[model samples]
Target: MKHVLKNALLLFGALFALALAGCGSSVTDKSQKTASLAAASAEFPNADLLVSADSVQKSLNATDLLIIDARAASAYATGHLPGAINLQHSAFWAKGRGLKDTDTVAAQLGAAGITRQQKIVIYDNTTASWGAAGRLFWMLEYLGCTDVHILDGGWDKWSADGRPTQRAAVTRAAATFTPSVQGSLKATSARIAGRLYDNDFAVIDTRTDEEYLGWQLYGETRGGHIPRSVNLPYAWYYNTDKSTLRYQQLKTMLESRGITPDKEVTAYCTAGIRSGYAYFLLRLMGYQKCSNYDASIWDWADNTSYPMDQAPNYADAVYPAWVKALIDYHKPGSTSAAPPQYSYDRNHKYLIFETQWGSFDDMAHGWADNSYLLGHIPGAIHSNSDVYENGNPRWFLLPDAGLKTALGSMGITPDTTVVVYSDSNIFAARLWWILKYAGVTDVRFMNGGIQGWQAAGYPTETTINTPVATTYAGATKPALLASTTYVESVYNQPTAKMVDVRSGSEYSGMISGYGYVVNKGRIPGATWAYNADDSAGIYVDADATLRSYEEVKSLWSNLGIDFSKETIFYCGSGYRSALAYLYAHLMGYTNIRNYSDGWEGWSTNYVEDPAYLATPAVPGSTDGWRQDPSGRPVATGGL
Candidate 1:
């Protein structure tokens, strides 16, 4: 009986322990449920201004909820959150200028089924670095949308979290949208210009360094930024992954750049697309007195009278004493016996050589056609290249006596600093080389030729001017010219680098444009260094300017051609190669030579000798050679 009683007690104790554990678990589950509910309903600091993804998801079915996809139509068409209406951000702005008309913007928003009464939640692809959502957010506020909010992390977070999405378009009943234009939100050109030098105001240029530094890749009349403006590229506001804004970091960067909240900040870009993003960010960060220069640099730069800070000067406003000294030294009548180096300054006698060779238009061929009457540089003399050539084929540099006569006719003395320019620069280089070879002490190729000069906003003239002819005596400088024999002797040497500056097709033996050269191939032991920006030729920039000095240096360095080696540049008929020779000289290369006759002369020797064509076209092989009985024999050495 005692044993039975003990068993009952043990069984009751076990039941009691189990019951306690179950009660504890029930309490813990209730606590977890409360915590989850709290997390799901977590609110942003300004819930009226911004909303979290979870909040937006929960309110998706609400009658007053108006989900807006602010991305482009193409992106919105792919796949968007369920029931989101597509309204592209760009629609808020004018076609090419400032903001659109208030009535038009309002009517468009109404057509998109946006009503002021609805609770608006805006979003974009959220994967791009651009502030599309922010831009729309600002636009809505400008239109006086009472309950507008931007979706945090936007569609990226929503889709990534396994939320429902639909490809089908969503439409809503048309509703009236009343716009309340905020005059203070916009900074006009006059207003921004007035505040440019104001200490209390800060003008921010939100563009790439290339644009800010006035490279003008976007086809501006002039290449420059607004005077007294600081650059803060819009991309800096977002994280590298573009997942979300780096709010605190951006605030710090702004403060460091003196773009403080205390100052009246105005931001601008090419056409205010980027500045609109900056405006939204400043507003979001509690900057009260911020305005967007909606007209932007496009409008500002278009107005020629407005001041612009040009490159190299804007960045380095103060020049050192040594730099100033160098500038003075290069000026005319400096009393320095040294010859003038390559300069873009208009301190020398300008000569325009308009050649019509190759793809150039026939109507504009040479100076004799009076092409200079169209538009020539101010105070420039037009000289014809056709008149300066000798030999049956034509366009060859004239003999010493003929060159002297031609130079004298153009009033170009031996000591005159002639700055030569042309449309293609190929002919200009030929003229420059010819002048240099003929012992003209100071001849410089215009850094970017006539195209660059015109782009720089320099003066142009239509009226022609004639200068009195002068006596010119010149002596040929043999060191600058590379003969066929001279090229062959050092071509295979380790210290020499022969750069074939022809097109890729010509260098690869694909198509020899010349009729005389029956067979096609590069010179033996020559490296193909085509002067091309892409697959095209070197003249690629909008203004046909030479690529930056660094870019040209990198191109040569990539091909293992450095200052240490003797570089030989050549091309078809030596025209394009002459430009390369001038480039090498400007780059301060010590041992650079131009094969003046180029492939025209080189292949002539091969065509004259049947023995050369009998053997296979093998690069760097002695079998590719033959004697030219015409006295210009194929170079013979390492063979």
Candidate 2:
């Protein structure tokens, strides 16, 4: 019985090397395989699989050898292998996986003079081709090719080494090519489902982090990654300049991810283009126990019960790709960035504003050519905050008529679902507050700004967008704004909780946080709710997104701010306060107001502190503030 089992195991190993039927298993000496995958091998275990440029150049005239450029025909037209045939990578499979017919592929190879036993070599432009050669190499091997190899580092390496290339294509006499489909080499959806919970199997996701983390790139019924799968982006296998990483470097990096040879592995991406490269990498690393999930999430995501992880919620914000999706609707259509729950479909009416302090020219003075600061999100109109402010020299809110005209010109109706973003959260919140004060309902703020958008692998636009005017008609929500007298009336009362969203220094009367403000000190009867001075520190995450409502509320609660009453938020000139107020609105605090006058107005009533008045008023470049001894009412050091 032991002899029979040994023979059966040997037979299975031979079959697995020639085929992959998703989850089909093969085994080698586990100890040697692990050691080889960890750079212990002086050379790659399957080093011969990667032929260098010199080897290929020397073999160019061999009669039995076939060199195939696996790049697009357009790239081949310029230059390629000396005697290579131009085979566009798409011919290896249909538009995506699961659509190719094996028999049809066999016929294609026969027509191209490829025999099942042909000594074939494949090369792709590694920098641009997303591992096209690797895809073909794996496919050829799966079809029972006895000897198949890929150009190491692909065309990028060859060209950099100054190897010879030719523009003309080559032809050979047609030959009979028989197909012996390796069922075990291709992973089926059923096989992946069976092994998902198996301890001995490893599933690798080769898509981008956003895709793995739930930014749906394709039309997946749902977003996110396969449960229990490990993320290792396909791009990581190569350097930033597109040169392929050596086997030693690659194995060392992958060692941390536990892609060891002991486990049977299945790799996948959106539709398997990237994972095809992944499959080749596994083989090149001498790992015999692996297969490619060709159909991948294209088929898996269509089934709702597939049990994906990290799926996005309905209320989650949209991403750069989503911006591209909607940008498709505009003729001069949208900018680049990337999507969430507030659905970003064309069916949803959206008024997107790139709010800034001044016009593009005015902003260019500060930003210069900085793309993140100067460019706008796709499908967004540029709206200047200056346009909505009265010439009070202190950025006071414009009259209702002026507000209506300014908003209408930007095609913003009271009911239009609006999204505003700027250089920072403060500017976005300022626009959010202004729109709400102007009676526009359902205003949204993207806190990450354009910098965050670009960081997510989306795009921005320099082309200006034209806004179609709309006649905005809505009753002004007067209660949302807190005038100085209105704030004084309710601030000290038990019914209202004043939240000072100012810096500790400003709240303690040491210095004003703003450039124009001359007086310091917190508002009377106010609590230090948020200590963010310019609105970018502890309240914001490292990724530049705002803190969650749960986190913000916890911080506010710790500061003794009450949620059961009307909350009035104030800052130097209401800019910072608007950000705090917007967070409250998002957190479902029913009654909240932004003190439009802020500390700039409140300081005028209290007498300046005698000690500060006696000291010479020195200008501070950092804060751009100088205390005034002009007998202005100064309310110093309040809780």
lDDT of each: 0.64, 0.71
Candidate topping lDDT: 2
RMSD of 1: 21.4
| Clashes found in each candidate (C-alpha, N, C closer than 3 A) | 0, 31
TM-score of each: 0.44, 0.54
Which portions of model 1 show Cα errors greater than 4 Å? 1-48, 126-129, 313-639
RMSD of each: 21.4, 14.8
- Considering summed lDDT, which 10 consecutive residues are worst modelled in model 1? 32-41
Residue pairs in clash, model 1: none
- lDDT of each residue in 1-639, candidate 1, tens digit only: 889999999999999877755533212232221111112112322324545565555555656678888888888888987779988777777533677888988898889888766777778765362667766776776667666666766777767766667799999988898777777778888898778888989888877544664455555677768876766766555553344454566566678567888999988887776777788668666788888777687788888888987544222111122122333455567854322223434355434343433322333565234446678766666666655665334245566788788888888787776666666657777788788888887665554455555644555687666657888887778777777788767877888877888776677777665653444556766766665322254543333544433345556778777768788888766677777776676555658888877776666543435665576454433333422223433322221
Query: Which residue runs of candidate 2 sit more than 4 Å off their true CA positions?
Result: 1-59, 62-64, 73-79, 88-111, 115-119, 126-130, 152-163, 176-184, 208-223, 231-237, 246-263, 284-288, 302-305, 314-325, 332-369, 372-639
lDDT of the structure predicted as candidate 1: 0.64
lDDT of 2 by residue, 1-639 (tens): 999999999999877775632221122222221111112123777767766666666566666678889898888888887779877547756433553788888888888888988778888887467667777776777788867877776778777766667778787788888988787778878898998898888888887655765666677777778887877777677764455567777787567556788889988887776788888888878888888887788788887877887623213334445544445653344453324444444455677787766666766676332333456787788777777776434676777888888788888888787878776677778888888888776676665677667755776777788789878787788888998778767867899988888877788888877666666777667888756544447566444566544456667887878878898998877788888887777656768899977887665442345664455345531122223433434567645
